[model samples]
Target chain A: MLSETQEERKMAEGEEVKNKQVLFRNYIDGFPKESDMYISTENTIRLKLPQGSNGVLVKNLVLSCDPFMRLLMQKNDDSGLFGCYTPDSPITGYGVAKILDSGNPKFQKGDLVWGMTGFEEYSIITETESLYKIEHTDVPLSYYTGILGMPGITACAGFYEVSTPKKGETVFVSAASGAVGQLVGQLAKLMGCYVVGSAGSKEKVDLLKNKFGFDDAFNYKEEHDLTAALKRYFPEGIDIYFENVGGKMLDAAILNMRIHGRIAVCGLISQYNLAEPEGVKNLMPLIYKRITMKGFSAFDYLAHYSKFYDILLPLIREGKIVYIEDVAEGLEKTPAALVGLFSGRNIGKQVVVVSRE
Target chain B: MLSETQEERKMAEGEEVKNKQVLFRNYIDGFPKESDMYISTENTIRLKLPQGSNGVLVKNLVLSCDPFMRLLMQKNDDSGLFGCYTPDSPITGYGVAKILDSGNPKFQKGDLVWGMTGFEEYSIITETESLYKIEHTDVPLSYYTGILGMPGITACAGFYEVSTPKKGETVFVSAASGAVGQLVGQLAKLMGCYVVGSAGSKEKVDLLKNKFGFDDAFNYKEEHDLTAALKRYFPEGIDIYFENVGGKMLDAAILNMRIHGRIAVCGLISQYNLAEPEGVKNLMPLIYKRITMKGFSAFDYLAHYSKFYDILLPLIREGKIVYIEDVAEGLEKTPAALVGLFSGRNIGKQVVVVSRE
Candidate 1:
């Protein structure tokens, strides 16, 4: 057994020398076109940790293709608030990885970890704080990239802390099957609130209603009048609106919001690619209804990660919560998988598989 | 004095027979064209309190002409949440009044109060609990109609409590010379914040800077690029936005907000009149910036009313905070005064004086 383990380590080191990488050729202009990225493999990945460093070397397993990554690739003046990603650099994103070697004591050899990993098969992480150790091997490791990772915490913190949902209150969620929205809908239902969600495709809409236990779901793309559709689904008007698609949907949601309603703004995927965003026409409803619309990032709620894990892990074990992953194989498919998110092609949480464990 | 008191009581009884009042002609379709209402002096007002009711009879001294009243005039199929004023009925609003008679223990005969009163000389109030006694007599009685009134508490609660200011942060106020905006700007200044204000007119802009002590003031009507103007004023980006004017101003403010910014939605004056209110075009900024925008009514914060008085009265006495009022002479001018709020015709708070002390 000892001889076999030594041989397996040597074979893994040999494979690490050959780096299979997906590179972002240039920064996206308006909407990310399919032709922007070309996948290519590189040789000579450094297996040993770099000398005099706080960095850890890891083999990437799963990578998340999120809407926020598109914002990072856009060429613009660094709005000075949040730092923008520079061109020609390897696209860095949240991923599940296995640590091959570590110079820091916080992590060790052969440890399974998940965090800000690269799109390539191997990455050199300078900030060890970014990576979180994977505990509990009972569930699928890929779950860390979507359901148990950023999206889960986002829905938990925004809905519970910001919206402060009351039992039997009406909730409206946009992009209902996408990562954050799916969890938000399910969480609202769990909290004893009536949930309604909107998606672009029929499959996603059906998934919301049947699979996720949402009270109602609508295909916003096919609906002629969004406000009427929202009013229909939420007869009493929405008490909480988990906003994912901004623009016209936001305007319509404003009209349908109940008095003293709370709108937890998660993401606005609709206007990400446009040179100029669409306007929200019914903002006065906010005044008459006395609504509270707040926008927050998942990073701000890291303090609640342990708390989120405590609640969600049990739900997952009991099969009370379901997360659908739109998985694409290989690093070469990463770009297309990511681009599909903007066009609403992905029916669920978009994820890319680098290798099968 | 005793003979005069009896004569005044007898006159009050005689005046009850002649109901001089303001009534909505019909539900308004768009921006209130002046012909929407007619003020008529009638015979016989409702003098007696309803049987088995905790109601009061009030002789209104000052009636506020707020922009929100215009929203009540527009016919919405829904109960219009918050109970819209029925068509062809007396327009009810916040005002300062003298209690002519009372069946509630909190109020007594000849006591002064400020509350939700009708747009008329005398009214029979059923929900007398919503009304509160005017404790401080040092300030002008008309102050209850504007500065020391709903708008005052609005600025205090929204800015101080909701925003929770930090020193040296950039604060922006919209409709800066209006009742709420004026106080918001001053309060921001007192918190050691860098404040900028946007008003409709050059005179109002001047008042914001010269009178209200805003660090900078701009006429949003004159500036073609509101987003650019916000970027210029809030170079570091706006940390707090007191949102009184919505539509384009809201869009611009959203775009210019700093990460973790707070926006207090006091009013949406811009969208109140439009058939379909102008949409906010750049709402996507909320997610990136992680802003908290909330809408609140002073009525909800009644628990803090006495504390509000303790804090604000001393500020007024020391001349640390100043107030502005635009008073109309008679109840007959109430319709035009309320309508004037939308057009920016009133300089500060628009109030109609029905009687003098």
Candidate 2:
């Protein structure tokens, strides 16, 4: 569709050169092994910009490594809970990028943006609406992927909007080690509620208590009886349950709920990979306790994005909020970095840097 | 605490009259046997009415035998579902009664009323606010206990208010033969939705198909594979699931629910008596399909009571809506009528008559 002069003409125009992409090796299965994905350079990048297009070209600097990314690596047959990810494609995620060339009206050359871009060195973005220009770059740019990005909004909405937290109420959050859960636990603490968190490892449990300022923390993996453990932690019974893991954990929380308790279901990480999820037996408690349980997606709450940033950015500046990032260097490590989520290899928020200044 | 009226009362007052009473023999469990209850005159009513008190004394003519009454009869420290019925008290239920005497300003002598009275000939009504005076007597008087009363409101609120039905959508109703189910199935039909119902007997299945105009009907007791049976009936998947029975039936319904399905939980009859209810294995289906399963109490929706009556009364008058009544005569038959629900003995709406007009 373009003339032969387009490639040569663009290079002469003083635009930055194109960059290579890291491609997904193949689709994966349950509990993805590190070998399921590998670095490949089969996909090539065109150096010259095409003429008369409204798209923007950007060099990706940082990529987000999330637990949901592993789910995107699985072969999709349309039978799994939520659709599966396809194989032999450039695996895309939330990333921060620097603009090389732009034909769009809003964005210009040398602009920095962050959004759902490619997990590569550079990308030709067809839709510019998804990208946001980096306005507050005083903080580390990588924070945009983990703390200021999807996970940040997720925790904020789940706690404030869905949970409808009240001061002095007891709050329980599951999977307290990961990006969203850690923020939710801290947010609950800030709201003046007695907060307790359940993580998979003792180290995560310690981090939740010491670093996140949670009132109490328990390693669910070490607990023999989850119900008893909850009773021990919350002897008065839980008023709000921020559910990140569904299955027996939900069942245990149901038993320990007080009258008029509320459950805000965010994600079900425990049963994500199972062929069949476990049964929840203690639902009868809902009738007796008169519990109100609701589920919500962060995408549905986009109206509150600006309000969330207005409140969160100032807290970050004042050091009232603390965020941790596990950054892996180079685009080649993106696959293993994503797979590390299921294995709990990352310390706080898992992220990968494709290129840095 | 009467003043000295011994000589004066003997000369002016007539001899005290004793009113007939129906007493429960004792509490019973499981499909209650006939011997569990008997009409015994343990006490006599005071025929001489109290003067100058803002209370009405009524003679109950008809009594509503609800399945919840059976739950009250079970001897337990926790009658968590329904409050416990005292051992020797006159069993109270929703009933149509004639006012024998009244000191209340609203209700006068000879006024016919239907409300929560007693399962006896004479009941001293302290508060008359709860009673709805019977005005339109053109229909069968027993209809107040079934079609025009509690069950009617239950069906209307569960289907319209909770399900939030869209025209031409596929709807599935469980316990399709009982008081609430028959009305819900008919309402769905009137709304132009494809409705399927599940009953306990083949006769009920025929009634749902022919009398109630359900698009399809199945006898759940006869069906071996509930999931397969549902799939066969609703190949396109269910949009609205009116959950009347819980445990295994609820689990089966969850598996067959379509994307963005709504489950209006009305009653869980199956799990009420069980020491331990069955665990639902496919609860994760709710997360995947973005289903909304809300358990609501009918009392919470009292604002819609008049709205329900305005729409439903006209349908009954036009013969477009049909209601069934299974009348069990005499105060002695009260316990058996309630017990009949558990074994699916009484078809349609089960009621008992304590007195003739």
Candidate 3:
């Protein structure tokens, strides 16, 4: 072992600062609660990267609270869609991080990147492939956690690639005011398609119609008969259904879908929390209408990020596209912010800020 | 009115020969039976074609017994996948017919064709576009009702167009010995795929493995745990699933589907007779696995018949593909043959031989 110099000794001591983290407890049963995860200050950080490693040490700035995280909390994971979080470990998801030290040639010290990371002050990302370097910063850096992140690409892929929408087509989005749905509704509007959105609250519904520019919007909670509500909104039948919430809503959407309709499955927020998810009884419509239902992940479409930005960046700069985010102030509020997602408390994309700089 | 000449009277008397017909009594309940349809020799036919008509008078030779016919017996008919049989009128489906007279330019008298027609001895086909002219007479005319007709094209479209299979890929076909399933298994084998099939009986299973050249075959009815059966066959997970039998089998198929798997929804024979269809519970895997479930109709792909024939005809001539037909002699047995499909009684592509001439 080489002897440490005086400057190295100072650097080593500075690295011993406390690293606060939100640690996931044992696997959840029914709905996840804030108590399912607790804030932990026991773990400390070593800021320097180990030599000859392909890992990069990042200081996490903003963390996203997504519904898919609930799916990861399940004890028995058969889907194996997103990997599960380990017990007594910091929960990982999409976040904006600043590179502290790098061993990989693709990244450098202090580069702003938004991708996958743990919900902690600092994370060692051995898999540099998950991280995409942030280029344009004129928009808020926290936007990387929501609109410019997974939700953005998800909506784009679903609307353009999966739905295969033609101009003047009718588009319906479930969970219309959520991070992905909001963007999907907007994308449909830009394509000159008649767009309708369904949300949980009146406020969210209003946001969908007014802010997101949906042709019409409704609060799904107020409607006693979902199929009737869908029929009333889409009298001609839905051509493209962006399925974010599954179960009865999905059945209703299938019933109202026109011949040769398309359904893009991005997330199932409603079913993720249930011990036993509801069975879709009206799938016979799939055959009758010749509908195509496809499920896709954003990571698969990341290769076309430059193409996505070519369309999205111009929309953002000109205010043609709008994004709504419900942000929690501090890292300590991460658990509550995430737990609130199930109860429909968050108005839009939920994000937790660890640090401003 | 013009006076009837002796020659015109003789021609009209000749056309008055017994027009044997199967008339639908009413919309069905539970299951369809022979009593639901009664043979009527009462309806008379007109021998001379109407002037300025785009119709063709056909002598129905053979009729197809399909599972989709059962769905047409439903009372509500909300799906509208197939048109319902009108009360006191004959049910229409794919059949082999001899054109005795034609007013359409595309069809001529004595032109042997196979297409959609009524379940009667003599019928007028005003919609001649649905008909396909038979080119090859080397094959039996009865083959038009099975191997060369709707079922053949259905299997082709489902396997090639929908499954989008690659050579050496794994394919699992449910209802393996049925009309479409048998052809799908053979097509998969011809593509050099690892083909596995599931049937209801040991006899059908033997046919699938021994005769159809499937890599492996299992009786789904014998297996208590379908997911376990699938896991045993495809340890790595299934790449493509030709979904013929929906319900429990579809649920299991979804559970065993690999990343980016495709499911071609051809028929849901299991759910057709049930008043309330079974609910699919494992749809959550769709989002995680990123699976694509596409439901298509063979009629929509009729334009590609020559393309299907380009591949299918060569296979038939080379003895690379073989088709099995279960013929129920006489039009009197048509009702029993169609109902037999629901109970898994028919051995292969069920056909009702109306007239050998």
Candidate 4:
């Protein structure tokens, strides 16, 4: 299979091939647009790793479009967590790839792996520490970009570890049709919780109630008063809140929170594209209701990936859980797919298919 | 002593006597003013418990002027935690009292106690569940209002349990000279943490540094930019933040918090007077830093009062802990003293001395 691709390009073992990539133009201020990045076919990469360089040369197959990528597009000053994207360079993110050649003993040629990689056809991943070998071929390889990957671990950790959910509790999740929210709502239902969700469109709301099995769902865009909308759904008050969208959604959730409720803040998608994020004013409820609002990420719980896999894999195989993805066909659609996240353009998890192999 | 007081007023054990009280005129909107409550001497009460009623009649001594009392002045709709003040009624609060007559076996005549009572010369405490007998009198009686009462338990629970402080970590306390903040700062220092505090005035700052044994102190009022001011103090970032004053101070502290930092939301005195509390704008750091912000109260930890008393009592007896009180003489001054809290008028723990007896 490796020789066939090399022969198609008319290249030898150590020969160079044209590497098409999407390069970030510069640091952006507000919402990202397709113009912020440019597609380039001017770069070339050797199929083999250089001698004494312990790196894996991989052929990029699938790329993920996540909300956190927007933060990387900004010039970070003090937040040392994310490595900001450099201008005129291929943007790096979580992706699935096939190793073509390797100087590292951990990965061999033709091995499939998923983790951090460049958004290019073929490249050398110097920091192979972030990559994990794919052993389960029974699942779709693109599942590594959503359910079996970052978003999967995020839902497990946020619901179980951060939210501290219990059976029969009332729960509310915002951005119900998104990658993490969909999984969380389903997981809450499995725990026997009375779950309600809010999304942007009617289609997403239908998917949440009928597809994800949320007890009830609402279209937040149609509701002028979010606090009233939440109160209408949760007449008794919410016991746990899976906070995906910040701004007014967060403020309203606080008001409707039960005594000693927990809010697992996984993302603030509503504020990511704004020049200045909206301020949350109803925090006084935290004191009055004795609420706990904690912030966490999948990276923080990566060590428990095996535990997450054990819990979710069975549910997936038994038909107890389902996943949805909106896959863009080619790498050229990467920029638009990523930008679409801010405008609620995608129906579910957004992924860009770079190559089938 | 009870007989002497009854004889001085020319009243028998079952006779009526003039009861001067400060009555709440109406529910307030913003900051409470002295005019919001009026001193009335027309009320009279029988100096004895009612037949078949398990209640205690007591003479009020020292009353606590706490920030939470401001919250009760508002019209409460859903916050069932606090019982709101009724129009044309004696304002209720924490106070030290001497029992004159008792219908319950738990409390006897001439026993000194501290708990919830009316802000008047005399009060019939129907709920004996909230009161605790004063067994140890070696410390000043006024200490019960500041260091040995609700505020004392608040500091102990917030610092040790909620914040989860580790030795040699960094701690920042806002409103450092107040009842709870003062004790929290000292407790953090005793645990070997590098402690810094922010207060409203230079005098309070001096007390925090020199008297309360805080490692560093600053006057937050003098600084135009609170975020820069916090960064100057906590260059390495803060591990634990004892949040007493909310609004801009909370925003500044969020920006300066270390990874996995804990914020104990004890009070929000700064926002008590505002019609609309300020919205915190820098909460994104909670996600980047993976911070935990929890809200708690002394009432939640009342079951652990023995544990708190065991720890704080020894520190007070050995002079390892020092308490400062801004005692306003006479019951008529209760309204003025409480109103002073919003303006940063009183230093240390504000207390009203109803009677020295």
- Per-prediction TM-score: 0.91, 0.81, 0.96, 0.97
Model 1: how far is A303 from its true place, Å?
A: 4.9
Model 4 CA deviation exceeding 4 Å by range? A1-4, A7-12, B1-12
Model 3, runs deviating above 4 Å: A1-14, B1-14
Winning model by lDDT: 4
Ranking by DockQ: 4, 3, 1, 2
Model 2 chain A: lowest-lDDT 10 consecutive positions: A76-85
Candidate 1: Cα lDDT at B44: 57
Give model 2's docking category: acceptable
lDDT string, candidate 3, A13-105, tens digits: 555546789999978877899999999988886778777878898888899998889878976557656778899999999999989789999
The Cα RMSD across the true interface for model 1 is 2.1
Alpha carbon deviation, residue B252, candidate 4 (Å):
0.9
Better of 1 and 4 by TM-score: 4
TM-score of chain B of each: 0.94, 0.90, 0.94, 0.97
Better of 2 and 3 by TM-score: 3
Task: Name the best candidate (by TM-score).
Answer: 4
Score each candidate by Cα lDDT: 0.82, 0.77, 0.87, 0.90
Native A-B contact fraction in model 2:
0.20
lDDT of 2 by residue, A1-357 (tens): 123255346546645444455566676556776666656655556544478878888778889976666556765432324454445557777888888778898888778888878776668888787787888889999988867887888788878987888999999999887888888888888889999999888888889988889999999988989999999999999999988888889999988887768788777777767766677777755644556666666655554676788878998999887887788988878767777777677778888887774
Q: By the DockQ metric, which is better: model 1 or model 4?
A: 4
Question: What is the DockQ (computed on Cα atoms) for candidate 3?
Answer: 0.66
Looking at model 1, how many pairs of residues clash? 6
lDDT order of candidates, best first? 4, 3, 1, 2
